[model samples]
Target: MSIPKTMKALVAYSATEYKYEPDYPTPQCGPDDIIIKTEGCGVCAGDLKCQHGAAMFWGDETQPSWVEPPFIPGHEFVGIIAEIGENVTGYKIGERVAADQIVPCGECRFCKDGHYWMCQPHQIFGFFSGLNGGMAEYVRLPKKAVIHKVPLEMPLNDGLLIEPYACSKHCVDRAKIEVEDIVVISGAGTLGLGMVTYAKLRSPKKLIVLDMMDERLEKAKEFGADLVWNPSKVNVTEEIMKLTDGYGCDVYIEATGHPSSVVQGMQMIRKLGRFVEFSVFGEPTTLDWSIIGDRKELDVLGSHLSPYCYPFVIENIANKTLKTNGIVSKSFAIEDWESAFDAATGKYRDFKVAIKF
Candidate 1:
């Protein structure tokens, strides 16, 4: 496929406004960079939070803006390599690939210590670090970008989910579910369902899923959740305690990014249990400190983005180990990004929404 001189892309000018630029310049590959022809880009919750004018994304008085606008806004994406840089090795043009959402500065203290995920100067794709995102017809992966070769035969639609699934795998690993443990995952959204999938692989005695939406709970059940609960309809804390013989669940994972879920996890997790917090909440959540340190003595773990799990995510999706059918509810062309954004943030709870190039 021939590369174009200019391409259409959604250029976010501010937290609330985005302009569709028909003449957006297609990226040129640097000596160590690679250019990918965008085929699919998932609208992440981070994108939605920024679009909704979250102060955490846009700056307030105390904090600087995390997601500066005036750049393309997509990170969870997959595509065919259109060009490879001269100094770039280990990859070739025409290969399918997914770049890690983050591009670490590599000179930071964390990078030097091999914890690149905590790199001081973090430049995430689509979040305004001068590197444009995959919402366009083409996107450039910088030299510092971590790239994973995706199997060409993997379902094109599911390809966009590679990032989230990897993140889920990492979160479940943090939970460290024991064979006879009772695990509860709060929220049955994409990542929550992913936890259900990966946690089931551990052969935990019971895997319970809690979501406010009945539809999402049903999907969790289909994803091999031993039990699904609609927290809106039941006193989920009491229900979990009863199911676990008043000991509470052995592990609780909070994935809804809701403040209430944090409190719920604290209440439902047993003494000495593991609590994994994986969501990026829109607001701050206050919880009792004693619950974590004194009363329960729970082992609290925080899960950030996918680290060192991309290969497993790729192989699982390619091998059909992860279910993909009905996951991406719909796909829209670049020209129809308005509809795509609408679907992503709409009342309809889609497992995933993609902008197809």
Candidate 2:
């Protein structure tokens, strides 16, 4: 297969500034790098949030900007290894592969301590200029990249979900659900549904999912959610309390970027319950801190990008243990990225949307 010198890509110049380039430079593999010919890349909520100038990505009064523009915008991607550097080993051309979203600096304190996902510089693909992402014809995986071989039998769309599913698995791991525990997962989008699948495997007493969309709620049931609720239709907190005999759920995982889900989780979780937050919010969420420390004494944990879970996710997805049906609701050719982004941003209320390269 011949590699093109240039390819189409969606480039980000700044917050709210993006353009599609038909002849962007194609990535070239370095001495210890691998170049992937993109198969598909999922559109993440974070990407949409960043496009709209989310404070988390564009920087606010409290924190510096995380995204350095003039880069492509995609992290959930899978592809074929089109090129491998001379020094690269254990990989062959034409094999399917996926890399972790974050490219850790390795020398940072967090990376040295084995928490590479929290590398101090925090350069995530698709966001940092130096680390271009898969929203292009080819993506370069540097030497430090944590790479995994995706099984050849997995569908491209399913492979595209590996990144988000890995993050969801990490969130479920943080919940530390017990067999008798009643777990509640907020939001029925891609990450939320993935949580439902993994949480079910934990054999929780009851796994509940909350979302406003009826279609998503229905899909959550198929993904092994014991109960699906629409906060708009019923009193979710009251209902949860009734189900738990006024004690509230044992674990709450928040996957909705909306602030209301955070408040709802706090109100419906048991006093010492595990609360795992794993969403990228477009705006600041205001909440009382007393409930966490003084009142409930909850164990609040924040889940970042997937850490050391990609292989598990890949294996499960390939074996059919992790249900991925209907999660990838739509796919668009790279030329039609605007429509894809629109569908992902709720124009079609899609569960997940992808850009097929």
Candidate 3:
């Protein structure tokens, strides 16, 4: 009953226009909604894409129409329950939690099929469709978004990584990667590195990471990549072929969404190999159709978001299997959000960054 009328948040709708203001109002709590006092939030690479006018808008193309501007945008967040709606009875006050940004309509066809990630009217929060993101003092979520009880074994601040972890887990699941399968990742940023870490758990016979940047390539090696390739310095295809004895990787996970990388990803695979496009592409890129569809008989795939990856991330963390806290190299406050974005996606940086609330 005592929620504040307005609070400060980072609001953006155009590339040249992002502002920090105190005008976001806590929404009227629906029966199933809970308010969260955000503790930490990440600035995903997709967040940077929105700023540079690459994110697609269903009806608006001229403007960088990400989420409705004037709305906060850090959906990758973790927090404590600040207020619970009358009908929300499961969560305790101050209970620690993280949530899914991709909120689904439970009655949709995909939801009926138990694939909520592909729901037709998929309402992603902190985008343009729903409440202010966690870049503020508090945020509200429907019970559907809440995934409670990350193990207390690891620092709760790292729980902001659950969303990104979900992405890698989905990729692993889709590829159906087998033990001893040779895997190659075509980017070593957070998502790519997450893939390296998680894919290794399946006991792959070989794992390699490819990147144009040496910093990322080195980071991949630190994460247990059997080999790391810098395309700037070596012929990636030749190296991969040599590693697999002219066979090819059983799986190629494309995490950068770069066109050139896609080309390499396809070429890096053996006949009948699977390539999961895990990155967010800025725009359409040309692919060699003859090679992609004809010769190689490749099984190219595109995974959007995770289905049930939250708990696994927590488990990985609790069990000391995955490293999220150490992967983050910088932190920025809500007021210094632009720098945080640049820091995370900036060319010289090789780590993830977050806006701590």
The candidate scoring highest on lDDT is 2
Q: Give candidates' CA RMSD values in order.
A: 1.3, 1.3, 2.4
Candidate 3 Cα errors over 4 Å, as ranges: 1-3, 13-16, 58-66
lDDT of 2 by residue, 1-357 (tens): 679999999999988679999999998878999999999999998888888887878898988888887999999999999999999999999999999999889998999999999999888889988799888999999999999999998988789889999999999998999999999999988999999998899999999999999999999999999999999999999999999889999999999889999999999999999999998776689999999999999999999889999999999999999999978889998888888888998767888899997
Candidate 3 at 41: error in angstroms? 0.7
TM-scores, all candidates, are 0.97, 0.97, 0.92
lDDT for 37 (candidate 3): 78
> Once model 3 is optimally superposed onto the true structure by TM-score, how far is the C-alpha of residue 163 displaced, in angstroms?
1.2
1 or 2: which has the higher lDDT? 2
Q: Note the residue pairs that clash in candidate 2.
A: none
Segments of candidate 2 deviating more than 4 angstroms: 60-63
lDDT of 3: 0.77
Q: What is the lDDT of residue 225 in candidate 1?
A: 95
Error of 3 at 21 (Å): 1.3
